[model samples]
Target: MTTYKESGVDIAAGEEAVKKIKNDVKKTFNKNVLLDIGGFGGAFNFPVNEYKKPILVSSVDGVGTKLKIAFLSNVHDTIGQCLVNHCTNDILVLGAKPLFFLDYFATDQLKTDVFQSVVKGLTKACIENDCALIGGETAEMPGFYKKDEYDISGTVVGVLDKKNLLSNRQVQKGDILIGLESTGLHTNGYSLARNVLLNKFKIDDYIEDLGCTVAESLLAIHKSYLQPLLPIINNENLHALSHVTGGGIIANTLRVIDKKNEIFIDWDSWERPPIFKLIQDIGNVPEYDMRESMNLGIGMIMIVDSNNLSFFENHLNSVNQSYKIIGNIK
Candidate 1:
């Protein structure tokens, strides 16, 4: 008799993998989570009383080829955290707080330990961001993926009062552009990085400037801004926000700028992190192309009133966040 296991899809392994992560996943739940793991669908109750006009904000993203680094280094946890945080910041730019998150994990064969590690990373971020890790799908397909390789993607849902939505109309000429420092590359540019850096050094090679192995620097978790910015979301001078992602600083910031206004960024304002510097030096990547690709050290950008600079300064300091007054819109 032929069984699914014989076809390379092990049903028992999948069940065991879920069983391992069940407890870790539960820890991320709040009162709003209506259902637990192993259900067909995840349930979350919206706190309607919290907002007079609640608007749902959402984003779907994956960690991209950054997983190549994970696959190379055999470090899976950080990439999962990167996915969660990346999704969090997407809706966060619009003044929303995370409601819940769901993830998709696919692999050629079921690896229980690695799956549990990834789930732990996901639950860790969910707990930190106050988002529910309600449910997710894990696919074990044979011959579809390369041996020992897995892919993960996520969808985040968040809610904020409709009146509190950040918009371009709030952005104006003379608005100060403040940039929040990124934690390394933050899940983008790895394809270029692997092509450039991997060719020059092994994943375990330690560069003096980085003070860590190439893998360590490349695996930095994507930073989430929800906590630091939440306190000032309603500030009148808080014009708009730009979550710097795949397109780098200028392109992402331009998404929220008014047509009548243009931003001037002082590239020299903040120092680029060593990983980026190493990539540039090795690849001789052009300025425009680099900005179009990597975050270049700044992950989140804001257009706020120059008059409220002190207000921002206090909040950033209170949160122990690093920032730079990189430019202005004019």
Candidate 2:
């Protein structure tokens, strides 16, 4: 008789992983969490009384080829955090407060240490965002992944008061575009980054421009915009937000913009990070392609009323966060 273990799925290890992560996951829970791990479905106590009208916003995302960097560096922990933060930022742009998160991890061989690290990262992000790690799945399929390699994806659910939703409907011709700085690549453009660094230039030959090893430059963690933008969510003139991701600044920003208004981005307004410059120099990538494929140092863009530009600028300055008036809606 054939058994499940023969097909490469390790039920035992999965159970062990659940046991291992339970404490770590529980640490992120608050009054809202209703169910613990190892259930058919996870549950949360919705605080419906807290808002006049509450809308639940959700987003799911992975780390993309940034996973390849984690695999290469044998650094599995931060990718999970990156995945959670990336998803959190997506809904934060919509003025949502994250409620809970669920993760999906698949691998051929589930190394206990690596798996724990991944869960720990997820736990950390959930705690930081004031969200609970409700539940998740860990699939061990020997043939689905190469040895020591795994993939991660996460789902985040958040709540927003109906009146507070930043739907981009308020975006108009006079709105000012404020560009928020990114730590580095922040989980996009990695496939192109790897091709440029590994395929074009040898790591041993450090380029004078980047000032770091290619691997170090490529493995920068995808940052969360939560702390920086959360305090400003209630500003009446804040029209919309765009999280710069796979489609880059233009396409992503356009998703939240109306067709009648055109967004004019001043490319020269912000300083391009040296790492991006190095990638461009090595690959000779086209300007349009670069703009479309990468964040180009601006990870998140906030659209605000032109009249409140100075107020927003002063607020951002008080936080000691660098920003620039990248452009305007026309």
Candidate 3:
């Protein structure tokens, strides 16, 4: 008999993976999650009376070609964290706190160790963000995917008070831009990074400038700004927040400005992280292309009232979060 297992889609292995990941996922659940992992659909109970007016905020993102680095390095865990954190920040721009998350994981065949490692990453980030891992889908397709190749994507649902919504309307000329330092590349620019460095250097090759191997520097987790900003999101000093991702400083930061207002970045305001400089030096990448493609140094940027820059700076300093006034809205 030509069975599914014979065809290489191991149902038994898939079940085993679910069994292994169930407990770790449950650890991330809150009182709001109404369904568990094996359901036809994930159910989350909205906290109705919690807000004067509740707005549901949602975002879905994958780690992009950055996964190639994870695959090459055999580091699967951080990839999940990158997906969850990326989704969290997308909704956070609208002043939302993540509620619950759903993930999609697929590969040609299941590797339980890799599967569990990725789940651990998702669970860690979900717990840190105070969101539930309500449900996720894992598929083992025989012909669709090749070798050990796999993909992961996540959907994050967050909620916020409508009265506290943030957008371009809040941004005005003369608002200062404060940039939060990134761990490294985060989840974007790996395509270019891999092209420039992968063939020329081994993943373990050491570079003096980066102080780490190519893999270590590239696998840095995309950060979540939820914790620091949540406490001060509604402060009058704040105008809008930008999560710097696929588009670097210029494109992503410009999203919150009115057409009449323009972005004026003091490129020299903060030192570019060494990995970026290496990428440029090796690839001979143009300055503008580098800015448009990579985070450079800043992972997140906040446009705030110029009058309250010192107050906000004091607040951030109290938390010991490294940030710089990189620009102004002109």
* Top-scoring candidate (lDDT): 1
TM-score of each: 0.98, 0.95, 0.98
Q: Which pairs clash (backbone N, Cα, C closer than 3 Å) in model 3? A: none
Model 1 error, position 14 (Å): 0.7
The better candidate by lDDT, 1 or 3, is: 1
- Candidate 3: where are CA atoms >4 Å away? none
lDDT of predicted model 2? 0.87
Q: What are the Cα lDDT values of the candidates?
A: 0.90, 0.87, 0.89
What RMSD value applies to candidate 3? 1.1
Q: Count residue pairs with overlapping backbones in model 3.
A: 0
Off by more than 4 A, model 2: 1-3, 201-208
lDDT of 3 by residue, 1-330 (tens): 698899988888888889999999999987888877888889988899999989898999999999898888999889988899999999998889999999999999899999999999999999999999999899988789878989999999999888888862478889999999888889889889999998789998888888989988999899988887888887756998889998898889778778788999999999999999999988999998899899988999999999989988988888888899899999
What's the distance in Å from true for residue 21, model 2?
1.7
TM-score of 3: 0.98
Residue range 75-183, candidate 2, lDDT tens digits = 7778877888899999999999799999999899788889999999999888988899998888887887988889899999999898899993489898999999987
lDDT of 3 at 222: 91
What ordering of candidates by TM-score runs from best to worst?
A: 1, 3, 2
Cα distance off (Å), candidate 2, residue 210: 3.2
Report the lDDT tens digits of candidate 1 across residue range 211-242.
99999999999999889988998777999999
Relative to the unseen true structure, what is the C-alpha lDDT of residue 132 in candidate 2, on a scale of 0 to 100? 92
